[model samples]
Target chain A: MLLEIKNLQASVEGKQILHGINLTINEGEIHAIMGPNGSGKSTLSQVLAGRDTYEVNAGEVNFLGKDLLDMEPEERACAGLFMAFQYPVEIPGVNSTYFLKAAYNEMRKSRGLPEVDAMDFLTLVKEKMKIMELDQSLLNRAVNQGFSGGEKKKNEIFQMAVLEPKLAILDETDSGLDIDALKNVSEGVNKLKSKENGFLLITHYQRLLDYIVPDFVHVLYKGKIVRSGTKELALELEERGYDWIIQEASEKSVVA
Target chain B: MMSTTLPTESKEMHPYTERFNQLEASEWALDPSWLNQLRRAGIAHFAEKGIPSIREEEYRFTNLKPIENQTFDFCCGAPVADPGVSQVQGFCFDQLDAYRVVLVNGQFSKDLSDLSGLPEGCIVESLNEAVRNREDLVQGRLGTQVKVDQSSLAALNTAFFGDGLFIHVKKNLILEKPIQIIQLTANGDEGSNPVASHPRLLAIAESGASFSLVERCVGDRDTAYWVNSVSEFFVAPNASVEHLKVQEESLQAYHTAAIQAYLEQDARFTSHSMAVGAGISRNDIHSILDGKNSEAVLNGLYLGQKNQLVDHHTLMDHKQPNCNSHEYYHGILTDDSRGVFNGKIYVHQIAQKTDAIQNSRNLVLSDRATVNSKPQLEIFADDVRCTHGATIGQLDEDSVFYLRARGINEARARRMLIHAFASDVVDRIPYQAVKDYLENILADRFDPKD
Candidate 1:
């Protein structure tokens, strides 16, 4: 397995968010996490990325044979874990392309590899930007400083493309995206996927999953994975809505 | 009466002892009757004030121990050695090829200076020469505008200053090339006393005339030095002047500089001061809107490292109606260094429709670094728009992590972000050459190991 999370429990600022999350994804598998608002979807991705704001109270996250909980956020990224944030940060006065290149070289250095020089890095980003169909000006602007919601989302995906990871986590990447943006970002993620990498797509609506089909679908409710199923389960949930799932889970718990 | 009752001897004088005495009793004192009177009064003022201590409000942020302990002799009046002026690489300035004046050790050097391509009616010369040759002009405008009582540093400058640059732009004249004043202080011997140099400036922009002045202060390394300087700028009706003060004083020196600018009716003045210097330094600036419909802009940046202490005090006085001023200063303090910023805006009762904004932001790179920022407004006018804010904090951890995640090491990431933070303020400076030079010096101060 590339990533294994067993009985995960986490909290932020003393309030519990993730209660119990048990899941495993093999190297070439893509899992989609669908849930309602405030269902700990973002908290999961943040915890996996080692964001300091959230504390993993009780859990074991193993990635590539190393305990993920002990590493820093940057170390997690260097260990081939990537997270596309829901609200990307804007760092004024730092060019977007330069920031991306620095991030990439930092990850490379952690992996004991030589850094790419300016000419080489520019050529790499130029090609990636073309694939994403992003404007050339996007690379020159201060990182996400004046970008629109859709543009910021696309930039996040562009960054993900630049920093290829083994287990990529897309946390509501389609939240602010329009039809065209959603399609471009989904295509970019798909193109970046390969046999050596896996993905965790977290979303609210079922719209994003229509483009990036998942091998396994999990329904999260109140910080716990209430149900797990195949791709067909996503269709059933989309057709029946989350109300029925909530009712069924409550009824089953009462019976037990 | 005061001179007769005074004590005969004072505590051991600072090194350039004889030069200081000669500067005190020069023949120029007898040449100009008005200057003689002003000198005596200024000396009395300085004697009363002396060097300020921490108890004084203006000197609260900076300690004067280093300056008080160092006894500096006036540098030997040798000519400036051949230190070639090279164009700052990677920046282009087609407009900087104009009139220029160079100063070494508070005195003008005509050999190393150039003022050939200047427009008509533009007079740029030494202050002493101008005082003797153009007595009517010098005597009429010398110390009447910038009040000496407003600044102790200004008062001290008036008391002991010997020579400095004097510039005048006649009515309706537009100077194409900026009149550049570069002050160079060479190193003294290893065991010799430190040198104390004071360079003064008097700039006047006549009615409807527009021009720019750029000043550069540089000192040699390894030897301790002291540079106490003051500049007085006058902008006449409907005229505009842009003054830029660039200080890259040696990291081992102590510097004190003051800039006072006065604007008349419909005048526009934009001033910028970039300080990346000193073991201990203080910059005092005051801009008075003496005219209706005048506007002023003040922008500053100071980067301090190790044990350096940098203090900046600014005041904007809105004496008339419909005047606007914008002030912004940023400090990047690292390695136990300290930064202080105190800015005040005073709007008088007659000064309605005043719009002023002030902001001071600091980035503390080390845990031991410190910053004290305060903004004060005393407005008697009801119809005024003034806002002030200050912020001091460390570099954002998320931003650092974001950069590191991509592949940069922790140190490189921190340095790049700091460079970005400081470059934001540097970009506003109009002179490309000075901006580039500041960047080079800042980069060196940022990472000495690298």
Candidate 2:
């Protein structure tokens, strides 16, 4: 198994966001978590990524046979976990090319591999930029500064492609992208997919799953995974909306 | 101004006054008699009013009790051989191809200074040496900008200041190479009993004369000393001047300096002052735009850490009409250090159509770090435009997390964000060599392990 979360409960600033959430993912499997607004989808992803704001009151996450919750955010990244933030931060005056190279070198150093110099790093980044169709000039500008919504999303996926993590949790990566940008972003993600790694995508719409199909789909309602199914579950939710699942989950909670 | 009467022979004098009288009577007495009279009056003025206390509104945030309590061996323009010329050579910006003047222990070093290839109409030499030929010009502009009633420290410097640069640029000539003034403050001659030096610079740029002035204040380690330095610039009509000062004194020393510039009609002046060292430092940057249609830009940055106290007080006097002034200062404080920034923009009633803007921003990294940022604007002109803002904040948590999410550790992530904040002001530097030197210092400071 790539990742296993058992009874995960977390909160932010004393407000409970995640309540006993349980999920599992194996190698090569792409998991799409579908949910309504305020269903703790993003919070779960943040807790797994070791963001300290979402305090884990009770939880245990096992990744690659090691306790994932015991690691720092950078340690998790070094351990092959990646998260594409919902709102990419704009770091003015920090050159994008230098930032990416530093991150890439850090990942390499953590794996006991030789670091790539500037020339070699540029060559590798140029090939990946083609996958996202990003302009070379963006490399010279500050990180995420003055970038359009579509460009920011594409940049996130471009970073995901560069770091090449074992388990990539993409939080709302398709929210702000237009149709063409969404296609390009998904294409970039699809090109990086393989049998050795896994993916956990958190999104509100089913349009993103059409480009990159998921092996299994789950419905999250009120901080808990109330329902679980295969790929058909996503199409069903897309057609009927989330009212049925939310209504069912509330009724089940009352019975318990 | 207070009464300029000299004290009678029966009355006692301040120690600084005694030092001045002793130097004037000893073998170290300067050559010029008129200069001696000026020094005598300056020390008397300082003796009447000692170091500014906390009771003064202008000095409420800073205290000089430590400086008042310690006595230092004064460097009286005498060249020493303890520290070789190689020290000054190694301290300079070698990659910078410019005319350089090196002042060690408040005395000009002839061997290390190079003023060759200067324009025929230009005059650049040590202040003591320049007085022999151009005494009238130097005497005219020396005490014109900063009056004794304005700053007591500057007056005290006028009393003890021995040797510095005196540059008089003729009209319509531009010096391609910047004139680098390197002030290296060494320790006391007898072990480490603490030493003090007062250095000064007088620059006159005539109409249509454009040039760059670079001042680097550095010091040696393993001793405690005090450096009281001052520089005055007289910019004529239609001239341009840019002054860049990087003060990197030792951490165990006390550094206080004043920079005064007088801009005439249609003239342009810009100052970039960066203070990164000194245990207790105060900088007074005062620029007076006395001429109509003149422009002045005052930009400063100070980085402090480890229980240091850095204070900067800036004043922009827009006296005439149709003038524009902009001031931006940023301070980054960590550990138990404290930073104080007080900036004022004063627009007189006659100064109509004046445009002034001032901003003071500070970043405090540690819980113990403190910053007091204040902006004051006094505009009597009804048709003027003035904007001032002050902000004191910490590192943005989201920005830190964004970097950490990309596999960079927490320490390195914070360092990167801090660098980003500092580069906003550093990037404005036009000289690449100076910028590179500052960046290297910043990198070593924030990321020593790298």
Best by lDDT: 2
lDDT of 1 at B365: 79
lDDT (Cα atoms) of all candidates against the true structure: 0.82, 0.87
Alpha-carbon shift of residue B348 in model 1 (angstroms): 2.7
**Candidate 1 lDDT score at position B395:** 88
Interface root-mean-square deviation, each candidate: 2.0, 0.7
- Displacement of residue B354 (Cα, Å) in model 2 is 3.4
- Write one digit per residue (lDDT tens) for candidate 1, span B1-450: 355455674444333333445665654535587876665565556556667788888788788877777666654233434445542111123346546677777777676677787767999998878878988778867766554675555666666667788889999998877877778776555677677777778888999999998877777764678888888888999999998877777888988988888999999998888877788889888899999999999998988888889888998999999999999899999888999999989999999999999989999878998999999899999999999999999888888766665546577777788888887888888777666776776778775484
Global lDDT of model 2: 0.87
Worst 10 residues of 1 chain B by lDDT: B86-95
In model 1, the clashing pairs are A103-B406, A103-B407, A104-B406, A105-B407, A106-B407, A106-B408, A107-B407, B16-B72, B16-B73
Give DockQ per model, in order: 0.49, 0.77
**Fraction of true contacts reproduced, model 2?**
0.77
Supply candidate 1's per-residue lDDT for A160. Answer: 85
Candidate 1 chain A lowest-lDDT run of ten: A129-138
> How high is the lDDT of residue A161 in model 1?
82
A76-104 in candidate 2: lDDT tens per residue?
A: 99889999989999999799999999999
